[model samples]
Target: MLWPYQVKTVPSLPEDAVRLDVVEQRIVPPEEDVVLIAHRQRIVRGLRALFAAGVAALGLLVTIQVVMIVEDRSRVQPGLVMMAIFWLVALVVGYDAAKGMLKPLPRGKWSELVAVPASGLATLGCRIQWPDGRWSDALLSKVDPALAANVFGTQRLWIVGEAFRGATTFAGVPGHAVLGRVRFN
Candidate 1:
């Protein structure tokens, strides 16, 4: 994708920052988050119901479409094949969305992390951080240059996304996109 003129590396301030609580890198199952276990389970139960409703609606649509295409034909039609592919993709998405319905639990140890600031490397656009000795990354937005320059160094950033929505990633986060972005913190 091409960025328009004036694409920037840093953002403006507190207004643009996403306040992320420093969480421990541990494999926390939905049940482990004791505080919200019941809430999360309830959501999952509701999503399961939604999944059933979606399947019913999509199934009906697919059935009618298939009948219309094959009613007077000796062989399957292009529309039928297209509908097949569409349902296939939909099922895949539905499966993944189900998995994402549950939040992810990150597991591991965090190293000095100081090296992340020292060595600047970009992966698929997001900055990579060194966890202990291995490389790791997250769905993070661009950090303000001023914040990064301070002693804390990139303690915060801004990102737009939905948590527990992606099949595998848990969160479907977008890239670090911004406009002129020179407002006060």
Candidate 2:
């Protein structure tokens, strides 16, 4: 399963800044089908739907309360104010959830791989430097902890977008084609 990806150099970075032997390469998947990719996408959609429903329900309830307060006292009441505050909080949360679903992740370009310090853990931090000097730290998710520990800076990687939803790691290197989810927040 070879996935095609577009490769472009950042104009901001000098041509001599870094040398990438292969700008574009065919990405081979570790497995015929990556279940984790689909599962994460489904989770993203489910969360978006849940937040949208919450926003609608809260909006309606707040509207009804405001109308009732206006009819009974002909003025804004403390109860109405409280309801409004709750609605505002719901709206903010819903907005953030939806934004995450809508906004596209920034295109990641593999620049350099930094060595990971020895840690007795299944996951190790992989820091990726972009051409523009921007750095993104991602956790290496491997089926075998031994393989993760052996990953060195010599490994090559290519950046691919939309390969996996909720994925902070976009660069694909050999052996571990798909790194674990990246943490933007």
Candidate 3:
């Protein structure tokens, strides 16, 4: 008799026996929700980005208009200068809106593994890992060290990064865990 770890069993069958295969791990309900969570996150992130860009651009435009009005102007009339600034602002706002609409938001949230999947091996669309139990969800395809420089920056990591991390770590979907423990096929 071999030890349990070393033992192997063959199911009883006909002369041309067909072996029975058992799956040790199967995807739980939450794991299935990962796709949905990813989609939602993507949408939220896109909206957040659009809002940020719009606010920043508006602030900059207002500042420029004030500076132009206060400072001495030679050739360009204040009204023309203001119109030019407004046009520039409009272009920026339109561009930002387009970009926001095009970009997808990925879902993300803060919670313990117990809230989602605790500990289980999971496969990413690409191989990625959480070394320090910390991960960023960033829109950028390439993970930039600069983006992770501060707590705020890392906290607001992009949608893509968040989705990827959420799928793996189960840190997404406000109430429901995106996954419980993922197993590869």
Q: Per-candidate TM vs. native? A: 0.36, 0.42, 0.27
Ranking by TM-score: 2, 1, 3
lDDT of 1: 0.40
On the 0 to 100 scale, the lDDT of residue 65 in model 3 is 66
Tens-place lDDT per residue, model 3, 43-83, is 56776686677667767766776676678554335665576
- Give candidates' CA RMSD values in order: 13.0, 15.5, 18.2
Instruction: Write one digit per residue (lDDT tens) for candidate 1, span 55-104.
Output: 77668767776786678556556665676567667867877746644443
lDDT (Cα, tens digit) per residue for candidate 2, span 29-130 = 433224424533665788778777867777776787778776986665677567767877877876764554344434433333443333324555555454
User: Model 2, residue 146: displacement in angstroms?
Assistant: 14
TM-score, cand. 1 vs. native: 0.36
Our model 3 lands, by Cα RMSD against the true structure, at: 18.2
Candidate with the greatest lDDT versus the true structure: 2
Off-target runs (Cα >4 Å) in candidate 2 are 1-37, 74-77, 104-185
Winner on TM-score between 2 and 3 is 2
Comparing 1 and 2 on lDDT, the stronger one: 2
